[model samples]
Target: MLRTITIGSCVSVQGLLVGQMADGKVMVRVDEKTYVGYPIPSKRAA
Candidate 1:
């Protein structure tokens, strides 16, 4: 699955879902690199 995460206040990344951290952060891989950050909340259907 693909997920989007925010690394900084203005920086966001979208990549393949790697794993989830214990502190509520999530891991995502872009190309050969992996990044850990807070996942963006998905919008609910209205």
Candidate 2:
């Protein structure tokens, strides 16, 4: 599944969901690189 995460306070990235951290952070892979960050909440359409 594809997941979106925030790198810091300003940067957001979307990539394939790789794994989940024990601290609730998410790991994702974009291309050949992997990143760990807090997962952003998905917005529901009204």
lDDT tens per residue, model 2, 1-46: 9999999899999999999999999999999999999999999999
Poorest stretch of ten by lDDT in candidate 2: 4-13
Query: How many pairs of residues in model 2 come into backbone collision?
Result: 0
**TM-scores for the candidates:** 0.94, 0.91
Residue 36 displacement in candidate 1 (angstroms) = 0.5
Off by over 4 Å in 1: none
RMSD of 2: 0.9
**Which pairs of residues have clashing backbones in candidate 2?**
none
TM-score of 1: 0.94
Q: For residue 11, what is the lDDT in candidate 2? A: 98
